[model samples]
Target: MSLQFIKRIFTSGVFLISANVMLSVTSAHAAVNIQQWQTSVGSEVYFVENHDLPILDISVNFPAGSARDTADKSGLASITRYLMTLGAAGMTDEVIANKFADIGAVLGGSFDTDRAALSLRTLSSERERLQALGLFANILQKPDFPESVLAREKARIISGLEESSTQPESISNKAFMSALYGKHPYSLDESGEIDTVAKIKKEDLQAFYQQFYSAKGAVIAIIGDLTREQAQQVAELVSVGLPTTPAPAPIASVPAKNQAKEQRIAHPASQSHILLGHTGIKRNDPDLFPLYVGNYILGGGGFVSRLTEEVREKRGLVYSVYSYFMPMAEAGPFQIGLQTKKDQAEAALALVHETLEKFLNNGVTEAELKAAKSNIIGGFPMRIDSNKKILDYLNVIGFYKLPLNYLDEYNKKVENVTAAQIKDAFNRRLKHDHFVTVIVGDPKAE
Candidate 1:
């Protein structure tokens, strides 16, 4: 059938179902059966077959995040990804959107410090599935990087940067990352700077795509109404035509900070934005479970957390205060952030430090540990309760080379964490004296 006919049917809602019903059908069970393989062109494929719903989700990831860009072209990776689907293989962005809309398929992607991902959610029927896959494959392998689109996107990004420069929250975040990472690529904004983005050319995008979007480094995650054999076929179809270049080098190690440092940027805003952090653990760290559980009690558990109880509930220094460990390809930051009146920023920050140090020195109580585990394990099902969530896990697993049974053992890992383990892990992983702090709208700023 022609795409026009499909578009008419789709618009008429003939092929649509209630999203809640579909999600209920795909709710994860006690364990997920993940099958793994490699395409002929060397892309690693992870598959989970669930015939309950007539929907399919696929995520294709490459090690082409902003970290791949050089200092001179710091926004190269981001712009390359942004412009990829805008015009590929003689198709305009409008055509691409219309084609996906015709079959009720969604094409989306994500970029971060470690990976760039392209994803598709479509009906599992052969016609819709194959058509969507064809367009996706073409965009992956044959992006034209049209000069007009490149120029337009560059202008859009540069304008955003200019606007963000005046915003105190944005200013604080940029300064915090720069302070925490120093010379590392993680310090670079995912949205390239105005100057760097303006200098990015079509040739730069082509080179970046060719070097990093290669089959050798691709991770394809497929989950839905398909057999293992069919999943293999789908993987081969999407990956076979990608660039054959070898995998790029690993991201450089994050440097350590030996002393605590702080930066105060003056802004005209009424409240101060404070972010303080140090390097934390990687995705596959041995202490991950302990740290994860510990962090929940320390600050991640919403109003029930120690940070909130001490900083917000009791003293009213701020409305909210929180902390989290962002585990990445390397040790991502363990960040604590809060906002308060400009005059109260120092008091809020001092309390945050005291809370953290007390937690580190004394460790969590048995009650706190139990509550954290109970909360974590109770919510475990939601983590995989839908195909999209499972697809996300598949991407992380494949990209980080995590164990195949990671999900199967997720609750078990959380359950096994103990008060002692939390204490040891936090003490070893975070330092009380080596934090990098950035405060914007500081009252004391000259």
Candidate 2:
């Protein structure tokens, strides 16, 4: 059958099904309507059409993540992404800024270990959409890689790197990644090191672009104020006249962390920075919902988290303490981090370790489980309520090839996760013994 015929059948018909029967399932968990189609140029789009608002939030994603950077030239991919909008086609960064400002839209870009994305939020009207879309297209397909702007961006990045090297938190986090991943790409910093940033060139950027930004590796997720027909057009419109090569780069492999380390750095800051973690789960893992819910009790829930409660409110060790797992295409970090008065740092770190070990051993308390579930489920809708939020979710879905209804099932998955399930997942997955401990403010007293 033709591709056109498949799409026609995909969106229109209601086919009957028995409980055991499944036909090319989209998302079994989410009951919400999620429309998906591949554009003629091969950009895939996921849509949740809500016409109630006159705004559109669209996100385009690619596998151009930091992991793809050259091992010898770490941070190249990241600098490439950051420099994308500085100049594209014939437009300077100033001109690009003016273009978006003129249209009353926002163009945003971000990347992590495994994916890079550019997002646009605009009035869904025709004129605004055209302007916004034009900028996005230009950046994707025609980034000029102008030498002058590249120089300026490098200087700016180098300055930030210099500043960060002095920062207690930055120093501590960098140490933790080095400890966690060893020689793996996950251990590399996205912003790169001072020496690497200084050595980057425009041709290097262009070569990297040519190698990575191809149709085969690209996924476009468009939502708001577009029909199926228009979305198909958008795929073509956005990805047209691009690099013609098939995807050639290998997807990065993040090795499982086998051990952990501890280190300390001296700084003049009033508080000591601490980071403890090891390798984390992947982005599309089945265990994501369970881990996410479980993490809230660990530290992600702010004042309600055991970390914050033990370190901040209960004992006044630090002003703030938190934990999060990055979850990307590759396994990322599951980190518990905080800062405390230099004098209190050693005691706080010991308590945090004990607390984590306790949680890992016994799981969250019953009250903690209920509170985490209530907060996560209750606050879920606010995440996807606006077009911008929808686009953000769509970006992840599109990039990761997630089920079209990932958001639809989000609440249900969280709802169905049992406390026992959470505990089991933690014990099965989180290996606290291999933690990479980094303290960047003072040495623990001898």
Query: Best TM-score goes to which candidate?
Result: 1
User: Local distance difference test, per candidate?
Assistant: 0.88, 0.77
lDDT of 1: 0.88
- Top candidate, metric lDDT: 1
For model 2, how big is the CA root-mean-square deviation?
6.0
Lowest summed lDDT across 10 adjacent residues in model 1 is found at 19-28
- Across 182-248, the per-residue lDDT of candidate 1 in tens digits comes to 8899888988798899898888899999999999999999999998656766787788789999989
State TM-scores per candidate.
Answer: 0.93, 0.89
Which portions of model 2 show Cα errors greater than 4 Å? 1-32, 248-250
